[model samples]
Structures are given as C-alpha cells and as structure tokens.
Target: MIGETFVLKGNDSNNLIKENVSNLKVYSIDSVRVKHFFTEKVDYIIEGNKLRRTKNSKIPNFDEHVVVYNDDGTFTFNSFPRNPPLTIPFQLYADYDFSDFDSIYGNLDKSFLSEKLKNKIAKREKIKIGVIGTSITAGAHTLEQFYHNSDKDSYPYLIKKAIEKLYRNEVVITNYSQNGSSIDYLGDVFPTALKDNNDLMFIEFGMNDHIYSWWKSNLPNFELTMSNSVDRFKTHGIDVIMVGFFQQNQSWDLEFINSTIEYNQSLSNVSKKYNCYFADVNKEFSKYSQPKINQDFCGDFMHHPTSFGHLLYYKTIIPAFLKEDVNDGFIYNLVN
Candidate 1:
C-alpha cells in the first residue's frame, strides 16, 4: 500500500499538468488519481473535456494515470489514444509548466530585515543563511531538467545566489529543512540546527502545520510553538523571516479547517510580535489561484512550488533582503 495511488476526487487538476506542449490540444476534467512510475513521459489526447491516450505515444504503460490541466486551463499529453479504461493507480512524470502573474501581490515587511541582514549582504561579508521547515524549504519539485540548474531552481539556493549576485558577498546557506516535517517537530530538530551561528534564518512550516495540527484543532499550541521558535532564534541574533505559502489541494476538507489565508495571518502576527520579516508568498500566488487563471504554482498540489513559483517566493523576499528599493515589475530568469 505504500507505493499505491488512490483517487483524490473533487480536486483541481491544474497542479497535475505536466506542462504545455504546443502540439497538443487542451481539455478539462475533474478528479485526479496519482501514482509515481519511472517513465520518461505521459501521453493523452483531448476529446472535449475528456482525455484518453493511444498506443503510439511515449508515455509509459503503467497501470496508473494522472490528468493535468495546462496554465491556460487546457489539457495536454504527448501520447496517442490507448483503449480500455484504467482501474489501477498510475504515475505521471509530466513536462514543465510555469505559473504566470501579471502583477506582484502582498507586502514584504522589511523594516526589521533592513536594519538587520541587508547591510551584511550589501557589504559582501560572510553571511550564513539558515532555513528551516518543510519540503518547500527543502527544495521539493525542483528538478534540474525544468529549471536552468540546481542553484537557480531551488528557493534556498536561489536566495543564496541572488544575494551573492546583488552584494558580491561570500555567503553560506545552511538548510535545516526536512521533507514532510512541520513546526510540531521543530523542537526535535531545533537543538541540532541551533549549533550554527546563522546571520539570518527563515522559518517556513505553514503547509504541514495546517495539514496536521490545524486539522487536529491544535491551533493554540501550533502558534505558541512557532512563537517560541522565533524567540529562540532571535536570542542568537539570528534575524528571522517567516514565509507564508500557497497550497493547491481541493480534497483537504478546506471548509472545516482554518484557511491557509488565516494561517498566514497568524504567521504575520508572529512576525509582528517578534519584530521579524514576513514574506507573504501565498498572497502573491493567490492572485492567480483566486481567479483560477493558473493553478500549477504548486507542482504537486501540497507544498512544492514549480520553477516560476519558486521565483515568486524569492522575489517577495528579495526586496526585504536589499537596501535599495526594487522595481515592482522586476522579473528574474535564472539563465541570465
């Protein structure tokens, strides 16, 4: 059962989209059943809003299947039509798609960060950047094939590279992030991570905390734990940057739980109470998700951001990391 795929119904198929291939037609469908298979690609053909594949296509012959929606709300796959309805769970190793935004959203509370970490980056000093939290900070869904390179694709590494480029400094990045870990487990990992003297530390754990703790009605304990973590890091002169993120799951029983938006507000409260910086990456991504323009920001619909989504993450925090005012319409391409 560990390596099995199950149907997650009444969910958005946007995040499952492999990528937009120009030659393929687009369709819309409900429900997504996913499994991971080691195939180079997946194929499908669009008939109205339905998807089916042929035998000649390059997608592997797995017993599972995953249907994805493109950025423009269309469906695409590389293979031809395959008959016989698939009952077993399947994996889809799809292509690359970027989330697009016409404008930036959210405000970066940089007042504290400017007085603390910006100067260190500007002077090219040896700054140690520490990051802690879940798979998002650990660089999930960051495949090199889709992005330019490893350094440019990941959020932590990108922030490291961006600082070096902007400040020409000798910077070091210490990632204390563990995949699928949350704030409740922070105490377990904190002592070991605290051994290092990090100039600035980023705390990112809303996704998992919401999935686990928020659903358990443990909101008070979750906030207290987060606050304590911030206080602990601050005691070491490690400036903190709290990250609020975007999620793409439709099957998570969102109506009954405290919303990610509200969770982000709680994070903002923590940042304010602790005099730390807050980067509301979720607010920016929500611009598209709200209107249903593009939903592929979270490549896997849990926490992993695509390459473009990663840019949105770093970009929101970049202004706070710098001393001078950054242009609002700025765009970052890793290749340059």
Candidate 2:
C-alpha cells in the first residue's frame, strides 16, 4: 500500500488542519482534482498535532474552497469537493485503481437494467429519476451548515450524474427523500413521487424503517411497505434500484446490527421478486469500515455519510446499467 490514509472532519478557522495528523504521513491532499494537491513542508508546517497551511500557498482556504480530508485514524476529511467548492480536503490518489469496485458490483443483479440503459443511451433520450428514502438517502450531511452542495453530492444525484456521463442521457432527479422518515412516510408521498414518471428510481429506507426496540416485529411491515412502494413504481413501468443501508459506529449492538441485516434480506427479497436492480452496499461498506484502518464513510459517525460514502453508493448502483467490459478511467465524472 502507498500509505495509510485518513479524513479530517473539517478545516480549522485558522490555517491549521485540525486533528492529530502528526501520526499520518500524508503524502498528498486534494479535492476532485480542482484545488491544491498540497505537498507537506512546501504547503504548510506541522506544528505539534496540527498541520498548518502556508500563508501564500495556492492551497484553497475555507473562503475560496472547503477544507476537508478522510482515511483511517487520520482526520475524518472525506468527500470530494465540487465547484463553488464543497467538502473538506480529501486524500485523493491520482493512480487509484477502481478494479476493487468490480467486487462491489459483483453482488448486484444486473439482468434487469442492461437493456434499459443501452436503449436509453442509444436513443439519447432524457431520463427522469426519482429517489425516496430517509435522511441518508436524502443527502443529509454535516457540511450542509456551511455548504449547500451536500444535496448535489448525495447518492441519488451521484447516480444521476453518472448515468448522464456514461449514457449521454440528460438526467433530471426529483429527490423526495427526507430526514428521519420511515417506510410509512414514503407511503404518504407515494402519490406525488409516482407522478414523476421516472425512468429510474432509487429507494433507500432500511435505516429509518428499522424499529430499534422491536425490529423483529417491524420486519413484516418494513417488507410490506417497501414491496408496496416498489410495486407501485414497477406497475407504473418505472425501473427501480434498491440497496440495503448499513450503520457505521452508531449502532454496533449485535441485535441492532442483526436487524439491519434482516432488513437487507428484505430488500434483496423484494428486488429479486420484482426483478428490479439491487446492490448489497452493506458488504461494500464493510470492506472499507474500521478495524481495517480507514475513515468510515459516514462523517458524522452516525447518519450522514460524506461524499466518499455517496461515491460508494453510486458505484454499487450503476453497475446494473454497466456492462461486463465497460470499466474505464472515465467511469467516474460526478460533478454537477
């Protein structure tokens, strides 16, 4: 491995990179190849536990751009920034190998989307997308207080941006996802969400749907509601993509984690029964989560995941539309 990586939660008010970065031998720092690819010593000096930026360096300041970073044990800086600048400094790898994403997509059911995506790309038709879920699906992030791009950086928008880039289809997203909502809440807006006539729909609800105290009893209702919602869309001729949501650090209780796993199974069952697209991102999240020494995608250490988390969400969902040999360097171009 090149070196251990980490993400700082955010930048300090002064020129300091907060968090004890003294232990992390950070060789590179950047956000979406747009801002400074900072070099240590040359860019800033490490004073005690904090890394400070040089006064005159080209490195983006909080005013010009968002300071962010993420990896393992390093500061929890995650998510790539967008123009107008968003997210903090992320430790980006110019030579990152996306081959690992192959395994992330390996468990997905692609039989339903290949034809759909190919047809859309061939005709060059416009795509309308609808996403319904709880906060995580709604693009809830800690950076929203400072930046407004978190919504644009969510998995829903990420998937929308990716399809537009790869298929050349003009994609428009109508995200009805809200924070703290349950499967029952989606039931309330089912009428309006279905009216969009979307070419694709991304549904994520396992997190909020889970009844922490009575998860066992709620499984049936969760499955029923999700199935009903998906059925309504499918019946209306809309293609749907569903994934199992996983919590990082927030709920590690054996029973709680088990409830989430059961919820994932419910999602799998529904997707299989409806013949819709499904990706088990819970597996992918595990591949990078802690005990392996990497920053968790969820920046809050709870609900809202940073851009890196959303990136994982996008990679897992888009494979259903991609082909066996379509992997490329240009595959990821999500900046809208």
Per-prediction TM-score = 0.64, 0.69
Q: Which digits, one per residue and each the tens of the lDDT, describe model 1 over residues 149-240?
A: 24345577777776677668877888778877877877876676677778888888877766543454766677889999989878877788
Tell me the tens digit of each residue's lDDT in model 2 across 243-331: 77765443233225577688889999999899877778787676554421123255444445665567667767767765444442334
Worst 10 residues of 1 by lDDT: 1-10
Q: How high a TM-score does candidate 2 get? A: 0.69
Off by over 4 Å in 1: 1-110, 114-116, 145-152, 212-216, 253-257, 290-295, 328-335
User: What is candidate 1's CA lDDT for residue 47?
Assistant: 35
lDDT against the true structure, per candidate, is: 0.56, 0.59
Query: How far does residue 130 in candidate 1 sit from its true spot (Å)?
Result: 0.9
